[model samples]
Target: MNHDTSSEQYILVTGSGQVLAVSDTAQSLIPHISPLLPDLINGAGEDTVLLNGRTYQIHRHLLKSESGESYGLLISLQQTSAVQSSDPRLGAIALALSDKLEINHVLENVVRFAMDLLNADAGALPIYDPDTDRLLPGHLVNLPVDLIVPVIGQRRGLMWQIVHQGSSILIADYADHPAALPELVQVGVRSLLATPIIYGKTPLGILAMYRLRNEPFSESDRELLQAIARQTAIALQNARLYQRAIRNADERFALYQASIEIGATLDLEQLYQVIYRATTRLVSHQRFVIAIPTENRMVEYVHIVTPTGRQAPQQVPLHCGLAGYVLRFGVSLRLSGAQALPEPAVQLLPEIEGELADGSLLAAPLIVGDRIIGALLVWSNHHDAYTMADLNALELLAATVAVALHNAFRFAQIQSQAITDNLTGLANRRHFLQVLHQEMERNRRYHTPVSIAMIDVDHFKQINDTFGHIAGDYVLREIARRCRQQLRDVDVLARYGGEEFGLILPETTYEQALKATERLRTVLATTPIMIDGRQINPTISIGVASFHPTVYPDPSSLIADADRALYLAKQQGRNRVCGVQELTNDAQP
Candidate 1:
């Protein structure tokens, strides 16, 4: 059979496949349509088929007598691609889209090209978002301001029908379609054509065209629009991949910078700030918070960013709240839309007021191996605010911060061990002398008075010998606790050696030192510590000394005066407070 590229071919055949008539254009294509006549007559009104090397659209028109009984069929065949290939706008659209790598640019070109190709009054290409289950307006042409719907679900209207069914829809008259947008009908939109944009097995979105005149869209128009939409899907896929690559590169750089700064930081506050900054690079938010668990099983809100005067949560039960949930399970939590917020988060964060109940939240645990150290959270007021990609970015930031926090904790443990007494959890002897020397140097420059006291546990050896070393350790611990409770925050209490403790009282005179020291002596002796169901009454003798610029030459002299006072107190009685001022001049520093 020969083909005619000049015009559409027409063939008239009976219902039983007998030829009745043929157009001059169809004379050359008799053999092509003869065998397919029976199938073509029964097929839906319009279809496309490949003949030889050209794609042809076959339109079936039923011929009936006056009684409406079908007798013959008039079939029309037109080459689709070959005819449209001659249109210069098709070439221009192809060339314009060849270099577009951005999603917005690709969408803009696709819509404008569709409008130009169909000579429609306006157009729009709404991109499909699977996360939100909606088609969001991507690009529009010649539409009035405030007319486009903010969002359209995938189950309503012509555009959504095509989205759900993966097919094309042509509404020849706006008033004829029951589900047509009333505003569009009122604005004199005569027709609407929508087709799903698909790439292989994936559906990207819809390509919709609008016409203002009474002229309806033909099958050729639907075929052309569907073809362009499928091609646009490929470009859309490329643009998304490019965007993800660029975003990933940026996140990597932020993590690298944060690692360098955090590794050099030993201060927890400074490290928190670095983590916050690094997180901002990955996740945008209206509020940011960092929470860590306390010894009492509570989540302490260590850092928070919120509006002024809003009572941010400082502490809450660790087994409650969203932050606790993240840390306890060591998993990431992402909540989108206020309507979908979990009831438990709302109930736990009741004090957070309206903010927590009406926002999207994302929380990732600061975990090292199987241990959860804390949690990082971000919040936004908008519904559907975060996606899986956003959550993944947060998880990456959490991983980086987790390592830094672990190292910081290890460093603090080491530093504490070096200066702390393991037996009593007080300052050790070396740290005590170091503090005494520092105070003396500072007082010497300012001419301020500083005082010191040396305390000894009376009859400690007898108690230890009778009760065993474990009981002795318990008594020492109890003594340190009582001394710490009675001392001022400015004073430094330390285990000096064996059974002696040193206390530094800054700016205290002889009188103040004696009163404070005597109180400590009374508190320890009055409260009998019960250990393992046995009452053990313990007593301490305190020596109070003050810094006099002319009398005490250095830290050692001050310490010596305090020790002499202690020896005098022990000799006079077991439970008493003695002052250096009361000592003989020969015995004083």
Candidate 2:
């Protein structure tokens, strides 16, 4: 155990157990064999120890040779203080070593240093998985490599306790501590130390060590682990941030792909599926929903995905649940745990009882400019598992999703708008023409009778001249409503033009079309237009024409036949239904 300082390898040391050593030719030391000097008498080579923080092997040597003739000395020595750095720049360089060094090399050095400091059998640094809330054993020395466990959120094990409480857990004997969960004893752990790796306020789980010897974990041992955990926190946090950024970039690329697919997808089901899959993958959630707000604080779930991964039917009172809270407040709620939630949230958890109580939740308010158009709810099974970084990433995704869905709904609205009469809330002239074309085609294809009716308000221009245009508009809207009320759901009613309205009737003969038109005229005559608290009666003239495939050749023939009947209605009287008879041979003149 005689020490050898003849080689200029050992450099400097501190009272705080920090050592600095150097070798110009190589980066590390390897153990070698030599003699122990006992012949020099006087306790030579008794209790000297050599330690290195990096990968190194210790060697025992002698002070003298030739039959052990000289010394019996065992001088306890380590690196001395003169060569150590007192400059702040040296400290900064030391700090940046972890960034420059490969993680494998850093972890190897850390494990070796930890073992030397604690005199422990083994140690392992577990890298954290934020997605699964688990720790995977890594960078191990003299330990089993496969040990992994959940360390955050809902897992009630020792590692989770250390991480969630943000403190270290030291146990002299795992068998004796009542605080230790049952799983801890089953691992054959005699004594264990679990300390959190914290970088500022963020926790990166724990650096844990186990001893089979039942030796008590000491204050010095805890300090050594604490120092290592601090460094580990810095390294792990850096790695995590780098990984998260990479993941975000990948998610953005996927989002772009999804956007292109969704834009081209006319199938609503496929579009929603793409949305849900992308949402759950990017935001770390299992369930999602789209709820649209309606009148009187009531919100309807336009789309809902159950926790079991099935899509529910639409038009349910979705916002009456947790979704309603977001709509009423117009803000996001990230609930870590439901039992610790507010009263309004508690009130909203009936239908989603087990799901809400056991899951983490993030709701993003869908705002189209200044208005709260809807909301997106993302749910996970672990509480408080998401960070501000994850939330910010998801916020971008929510914007994309909201804009896409809003665009889809708007597209549907535009399709319907193309044919709608805005002022009267009826079908416009173009819609009337389209319907006539479709009806004529259907009749020709099926050889069935189709009816057409043309109705004009009686002296509508005179009425507009008598009353103001506003009153005329009000009268027109009233006539549209009465016409709509008198028709069946399958019937088509539209404002044909300025003073004209038209209807296309499927499976109706000429006689039946005339009867339906007369009823529409009667209804308009009885319906009073209330403008400025004054009531005015309105009348309408009607014309009816019907043809089967055997009679009219095309849509043009149907419109011409209907126009002739309309002329006859004007010839007979203003407010009556008139049907056209076929032109006789004598009437050819």
Candidate 3:
């Protein structure tokens, strides 16, 4: 077995399996043969092994001298198959695929590398389409642009066979294969090789290479193509996950920006603008509408923005329209095509009927706690234009909008309570003084005349004693209402104190103030407030005061003068108007 030692490649290894010497022809095979010495020495016969993409036959024999004692093992290495290591292009392609973040770019690189490394004339990367249950062309190299590759399915084309079996296939003669499509044969494809692009247990697509001549693909070619498909699968999966992560980050940022911008203002109009700008970042809409529930159980359109212009606010029943449906159920909705325009929505939202007829719609309830306060509605002019992602983004924005609106409404309520009287719905005493101070400051600066009046319900204590406090409150409320109806829009009316009211008339003289007070007195006296079943006539005594630079320079002095005139009117009789000038002339020494 040891004849012609010069022609055979041999490795000398110690009994413990470490290379001690290698023949001249075996030097190149040392690295591959050294690791297999232990297994060859332990085995009783010759064996074959694969190394560096090449097959080699191993023969192990005891190295003995004249004493017939074993000191080392002589491993005979004989070349079997001529397959070499992976093509250098595979390494470059792996590097290129690692740098790509887009799926299409990765697929293209896979096809190009497979065609160049395998020496194929044409190649294609077809992605699996779950919707069609087929493989669709993703990227093509040296393939006709208009050539339609047949879809991959069970017992179908070469690509389908590879994907279905989860293995690489080498069709040495595509014409002899029963599953070969005519389109491929017509394209002058004589041989083809396909490998399934698998990620984990799932098949993502197929990487296929075609040759125009009858050159059969080698085993190394099949192995290299499969390796490229594996790399391509990993690249594509990574790209898809990276894209999803980016989208999620963008969505979160949009919601955060919307919260900040919308919460920046308490003004209703400015709030609407911020909401619109923030929402446009996530989804574009042809029309935007905000509807809130009214006290009468009706949904009122508080804001509406369309492509043309904003519409006037209108009220609709709570059971009407898509917005109403979301409000009633407290659920989000995404409707497209025919379902976007239901009969109820068409009947209630006639203004937006055209938008709903041919477009898509998304709506989410503005919920605070367990209550559905309102609804946010958006419409687009394209059918099925919105996805679940869009709906989710809108819902996030809706939550922020609802919270902002709630805060603004609460702030308005608190501000109203701070300035208004709870009983009569007029400005309170503190606000009245503030307004008077402002007006007096204006008068002092510009030397302009401003008038003030004090009105008191005559004999209010007597009415409270006779008819009870309830009837007295009724009288006061009615008198305040009637006096308010007599004032101009520029005039300020306030409940100065219990049973007393104050009025500020801008740009009015003493005579004009007297006339206005007289009108308020007559209105109160003429209107009898019916309390419980009795008609009670109420009279108001009014006093007018004018701001003069030399006479009443300060707000307190002006108020004091008005009060003195009111005392004079009350002393004379109720239901009368008296001026400060008349009182001052009477008090002259």
What is candidate 2's TM-score against the reference? 0.57
For model 2, what is the C-alpha lDDT against the true structure?
Answer: 0.64
Local lDDT at 365 for model 3? 91
Q: Which stretches of candidate 3 lie above 4 Å from their native place?
A: 1-243, 261-273, 308-317, 320-322, 341-347, 350-355, 439-451, 482-491, 505-523, 545-552, 564-573, 576-589
Extract clashing residue pairs from model 1.
Answer: none
**Root-mean-square deviation of Cα positions for candidate 3 versus the true structure, in angstroms:** 15.9
- Candidate 1 Cα outliers beyond 4 Å, as residue runs: 1-86, 116-122, 141-159, 172-178, 181-191, 211-220, 290-317, 337-347, 350-356, 436-453, 465-468, 485-491, 504-526, 534-541, 544-554, 562-589
The TM-scores, one per candidate, come to 0.71, 0.57, 0.56
Q: Write the per-residue lDDT of candidate 3 for residues 102-152, one digit (tens) a residue.
A: 678888778877787888999988888543366777888888866755363
lDDT string for model 2 (178-238, tens) is 7665544665668887688776676655677777687878876786677666555545544
Q: Which digits, one per residue and each the tens of the lDDT, describe model 1 over residues 473-551?
A: 9999999998999888899999998889999998887788888899999999899999889999999998888776677
Q: What is the C-alpha lDDT of each candidate?
A: 0.78, 0.64, 0.78
1 or 3, which is superior by TM-score?
1
Cα lDDT over the full model 1:
0.78
